[model samples]
Target: MNDGWISDEEERTPQVTPVYSQTFGRGGGRGRGGYGENRRARGFNSRGNSWRDEGNSGGNTQRDGGNIGGNTWRDGGNSGGNIWRNEGNSGGNTWRDEGNSGGNTWRDGGNSGGNSWRNGDENITTLAVKKNNVGRIIGKGGSKIRDLESESGARIQIGKPSDEDYGMTVEVTLTGSEDCRQTAKRLIEELTDDSAPRSYGGNSNSGNSYNVEEPQEEKPRYIDFAEANRAYEEAQKERWAQLPPLKKNFYIEDPAVAAMLPEEVANFRKVNNNITASYALGQSPENSPIPNPVQTFEQCFSEYPEILTQIYNQSFTKPSPIQSQAWPILLKGLDLIGVAQTGTGKTLAFLLPGLIHTDLQPIPRSQRGGPNVLVLAPTRELALQIEKEVKKYNYRDIKSVCIYGGGSRRDQVNIVKQGVEIIIATPGRLNDLVQAGVIKVASVTYLILDEADRMLDMGFEPQIRKSLLDIRPDRQTVMTSATWPEGVRRLAQSYMKNPIQVYVGSLDLAAVHSVTQRIEMIHEDDKIARLFEFLHDMQPDDKVIVFVGKKARADDISSELSLNGVSCQSIHGDREQCDREQALKDLETGDVRILVATDVASRGLDIMDVTHIFNVDFPRNIEEYVHRVGRTGRAGKTGEAISLFTREDWSQAHELIVILEEANQEVPHELYDMSQRFSAWKEKKNEDRGQGRGGGRGRGGGRGGGRPRW
Candidate 1:
């Protein structure tokens, strides 16, 4: 017997006699190697007999062979065995009499627990553990293995490496009851991870060398999407909170202004302010009172005779409403925000003052560090146009240049180095030059941000902020926008210093009254056919600007129109800068009477005699629609704006009606029906969704059980 294996029966032989009495017969004797034989021979039936037979019968009994029931084990003179025995009855009582009944039982000598063969509950299992993990299972001084044995009631054995394994792995053996062996194996796998080792053996017969590689350590990184989104929202909120609030509007009364003016100036104010348009002043401080509007060329440039002479040379007639109020505020060296329609003279409103501010600086042009005036435009076309306006008034020969993306970088850099007083640039190229050290902002005393709202929408706020970071805070700043949106208000609050606002009309978004707005509800397939029909009725010398929603659509329409014997040109962001410029030039020079374009030409474009604005596709929003219609009715000219609306644009019907009503234009009944139908469909969809989510219950708890605004 193994010294480590202890038997419960041997340890308490005297105490377990009573318990063994019921299992064994009352007079059964216990003897060395005779316990199983005595129980099977004395108390149990003999081999090859029936289960009920105790003593063998010499003569044939009632249940004997060939009798009715005698010797049931070999009844009917059968050579084949019955149910419990095999054929010939030689394998007597296979289940009870031969194997388990007398051999291999707990009452036998195998009950000692040191038996070499396993009984029913005993089990053996093997695991292959990697060399590196062997120490993990054994622990310090084999303490872990000892604890595992005591806890699981299992015997654990470590074996030497086998020749085939090449010492890369060690074998672990576990011996115990089934449950105990399983518990110990699970514990070892948990401690050592029990992964199969990697082996690169060439050959075992030739005793070739083996290569083994340790598993690489794994370190994983994670990103929290929810936390990242929360942080981004927080950053945006903090950025918005840094700016001050916008000041309220202060009305400009005609009587108060006319009381202090001459008759000529009073008539000008009466004819223009509050009648032809509205005027309002805002955020102006009491220390510097606001200046009166300049109505004429003489009144505007009376202090500078050279400027007046240049104005006459350029055929000056009168001041536009925006220019009339904007010039006075900008000329006083105060920050100004000019809000008006797109066709209003907003460019010259700030440009002339910028030129005057640059030329009149205390430092001479040569001594000033770089350009003294900087104009930031949203598009290259607008920048070039502003530069052209600056050239028209050559006061004191003030040099200027326009630099933008897709232009010759070397040429622009050379122009900057040659010492210009005025610099017109788009935000992108201006930032690039600033980073490249080719332009300086420290000496820029006059700054103008044209089309401020468009610049914000195009995601140019970062470049604008970076460009302004180095400029002196006290510099004169002027900003212009067609609509005063919240983003534009926040930007103005951050950059301007109590700027005075001079808006020509109502601040609410409205189309120009000069443009006769018309809407026609049509099918999507009929727009092309209808377009040519509209173009056929065009009067001679009447120009048109066709606005589409996308670049590809603009090219398609232009090509179709040209093939149908109509002259046209297409312009969009994807076109080259020179090509866009040429397209505009062709339209203005009547080389092409129709200009097919996207929203890129909606704002800051000045083309004379553009008698009509046609919308091939209604704009994405009402704000863009307003800007597109304003393209034709510019410079006090009357024009017509026609839009083709389809069912796909039903989502914008409500907002389009509001704009049309504000402009006093007719709203078609079909548009109202479309809006009503879309609303009904949206409400029905939400109802069905709510019913499904609530499982027939009325209105689930959160968010009314359905999403808002499909």
Candidate 2:
């Protein structure tokens, strides 16, 4: 038997002889029984009979005289012909039959005339694979190799790297039967075919055939409109379930006061105080009370006489438009939704009316487990600010406590146990106390949600609902925000009963007219230098608030400004409550001329005499921009708001332009151009999206066709 070599090529022709050779004398005559005379084996037939002769001989010998039978032997004359055979019938055997007319040797036992090539023995086939494709074939951590082995039932082993300076190829060895080897080889050929590189429009290599395929354009994926609507409806239902329930036994016993005369209403809608056209009065009375414009606090302080004395002592002479309008509706015991510019005395508008209502029917001290009013603000600073204003109204007799997160809970608990008449808190901390039973809201009659839009934006809707559930059903709710979004309207519809919506200006979400806004398009690298330039122009006595986008940015800019001899104090959400209070106090008392802050100070911050607002980083949205600029230009004072815009603010360019144009401020050419480009891009995006829905092809209508619009 000869050892055979396997080639790496996929196909090869067999070169081995199939006949078994014998070194014995040749037989002469043919037997009449079965043996044919001078017959030679071309190849093994299906019966495995093959014959070859070597030496010269004489008369022939026949096996069984006709058929090749088991263990049959024939001896020829003259040369001492001897034949030996085994009939064990094991399938795999190698025959080395040598006959010198003496004898023949038989090794493993198998059928005498049967095919002895068994497929059970292991056979190995090796393939050389490109080095680049080995990792792909192996997949992540040999997952593909395991899968291939499972599918082909072949054990595969990848060879170690060789040091030869030949082509970069790795050896992949497969060990299995013939069929298994063929299956695995076919699979590997398919894998290599897929991994082969082909030029899209160029000629192929002269030595290699390329399997070029024309790329197919992907089609746009359109969402099923009915499925999307169903999902949206389900989500809305979930949100509604979390909302506060309406009062069951509560009803408006007395109708609202008669509306003020048309001339009086017209006087309230003077320049710089025009009511927004989009304001809606839902379920409001036909004769809802419309208070006349008052120039002094005395005219607006008719319900509570003690509030008048406090007003006189504090030198409160006049009312802002929001105050004058909100006073009448709130005093009439109706729900109120007020939308006014930031820093327009909205805090006092709600606080004064709430106090007057509290004085009308005071909760007895013995039965007071909670306060009579619950004021919910978005942030700790605003909550504290509200508490301060409540104190300013000569509330020595009417006790109030301020509670928020990051402060001592024990102290708040103690204060609540002391029978306070009012509680001002942030939603999170108030909800915590309510759950712990440290504070209760069942007896609370008045609820104020300040900066309601911000609260909802901060994902406090669920918390707000949980807190509202504990309060009385007939509670008088007043929600005030700089912008009235759809969420606020939903909130009113869910909780407030016949809420009278009051808008102090055009509801178009514009910056305050008292603020002169200047937008400069500059690179981010030049922002620090431009800020220094503005600082040089600012006087030492001028109070300024610089707004940054992040807390880290606020600290960085504040430190830089302070190092340059500017008295700057920074405040952000991470700052301790005491430190934040001190920072605001420093800015208010002229101890620090510059205050650096994030959007935490954008709303409900009443720092009097803020001469300038520098937006070192733009706000995230247009409503935030309005509120950030509103931090300055308070108390009927003309102030300036300067913003530094960069390429990152391109999406906000259109909104910035609208705000500037509405305020009658000069819009920079660069900003206007960016706004126009942004508008065009948005229009094109919408058009493409529409085409996608209609199953039409466009520049960006294909699946994942282009960059996202934002």
The TM-score, computed over Cα atoms with residue i paired to residue i, of candidate 1 is 0.62
- TM-score of each prediction: 0.62, 0.62
lDDT of 2 by residue, 299-339 (tens): 56654567778877866557777886677667767777888
* lDDT agreement with native, every candidate: 0.71, 0.70
**RMSD of each candidate?**
17.4, 17.3
**Pairs in steric clash, model 2:** 34-65, 89-111, 276-507
Q: Kindly list the per-residue Cα lDDT of model 1 for residues 180-280, writing each as its tens digit.
A: 89999988786665344432222224465454455778888798999999998788667644432222222223444435555555466556743122222
lDDT of 2: 0.70
Least well predicted 10-residue stretch by lDDT in candidate 2: 2-11
